[model samples]
Target: MTNISRSNYDPEVEESEYDRLERRWTEQLSELRVTQAGTQIMMGFLLTLSFQPSFETISLFERNLYLSLVITATLATVLAIAPVSFHRILFGHPGAKARVVSITQVLLRLTLILVALVLSGTVALIFNMVLGTTAGIIGGICAVVTITTIWIALPMTVLRKLR
Candidate 1:
């Protein structure tokens, strides 16, 4: 057996630029799969809510909030799946994978933002219907803060530490 020098040896395998881009694309697609599932479920829930008999009893503000959430959820669903369309369109072209991956990253961020909004708004709407307006607003704020902390702040902190 040949002995490998520890200082000269890279434990991590080096990937070519093309291979790196492909790996990034694959990872992005995996993330999209998770995001898409949740977005589609939320979209379906929002779509069916309007068909429910109790939906008619909602206050005007609640109705408006529900409508906004439905729109936001729909947007999130679209954004979550948009990367696939982009990849398909850009397929087989030289250097297109990089572009596809970049676009996917942007779309993923936007999708997450819209999903966060839908979640917070849904919570607020439910609280308003069950409790009161103040409670609803508070619930929405709390949801926003929690999501921001977990999704954005934590990532930023980790990145800073790495740097």
Candidate 2:
């Protein structure tokens, strides 16, 4: 009937702080690699849109949306790569690995938000161009909802359950 305390310590998989940090950094790098590739590709596509012959024919609103998407995508790409730059600049400094990991986690979250916006905007733009304004708005809203549910809500729910 006595209280028992539970600890996360697992002797079978012992890891030093430095080793844990290294593993986290490695995993973060892998995630960033994937995100960077997608963001760059999206940026490239957005950049090429203006050169198309039909680009000049779009409404002002569409043009503004496209510009915003381009800017957001660029920001996302920069954030996705910021972790690597931070690590490079802080390399070999004491406690730098932990700092890099913390910064990387923040950057990654921001990048994901920007990526979601870019994706939703892209869908809106395409729908607006092909269908109508109402369709475009609906598509964008649906995209946002779906992304939020999958990316943010799902993780939060799992974390809450774990806690």
Candidate 3:
């Protein structure tokens, strides 16, 4: 184990599990607010492309890619917001906080993956439309690399070092 401890947490301070769960829930909710905003913006941008005149000129592959992006992005949005819905439904029930947090964490991870795909798809679609199929493939690869490095590997490395 990394033996990591919270910078602001005081070991001397006694707290109940409920209290801990409440604090964690609050923190995750705040984080969700940030993620949800980004998802909304991406989805909004993706939605506008369907109406573009150039949209009709895309190849079957590009059209499928766009459609997949729309689906993935929408699913990401829903998954990101699922915790709140789960919270509302389970609020005040016994062990509600723990249940909500656990469920949300899994959903959040899935949401990240879908969001990553949506981002890569968006890049590929635009680059293909503007530059060429080869350029679009390059763009998609770049987006995937960027997201994986910054979102997963960087954090995992920092965590490993802390451990």
Give one clash count per candidate, in the order shown.
0, 0, 1
Which residue ranges in model 1 land beyond 4 Å of their true spot? 1-13
Question: What tens-digit string does per-residue lDDT give for candidate 2 at 110-150?
Answer: 99999999999999999999998999999999999999999
Q: Write the per-residue lDDT of candidate 3 for residues 1-163, one digit (tens) a residue.
A: 1355677455335668778777778878887898798789899999998998978888999889888888889999999999989999998898788999889889888988888999998998889988999999999999999999999999999989867
lDDT of 1 at 67: 91
**lDDT tens digits by residue: candidate 1, 1-163:** 1376765554335678888888888889899999999999999988898998999999999999999998899899999999999989989999899899999989999999999999999989888888999999999999999999999999999889866
Question: What TM-score, computed on C-alpha atoms, does each candidate reach?
Answer: 0.90, 0.89, 0.90
Count backbone overlaps in model 2: 0
Rank candidates by TM-score, best first: 1, 3, 2
After TM-score superposition, what is the CA distance of residue 129 in candidate 3 from its true location, in Å?
0.8
In terms of lDDT, the poorest run of 10 residues in model 3 is 1-10
What would you estimate as the lDDT of candidate 1? 0.91
- Give the top-scoring candidate (lDDT): 2
Candidate 3 global CA lDDT score: 0.88
* Alpha carbon lDDT at 95, candidate 1: 84
lDDT of 1 at 29: 84
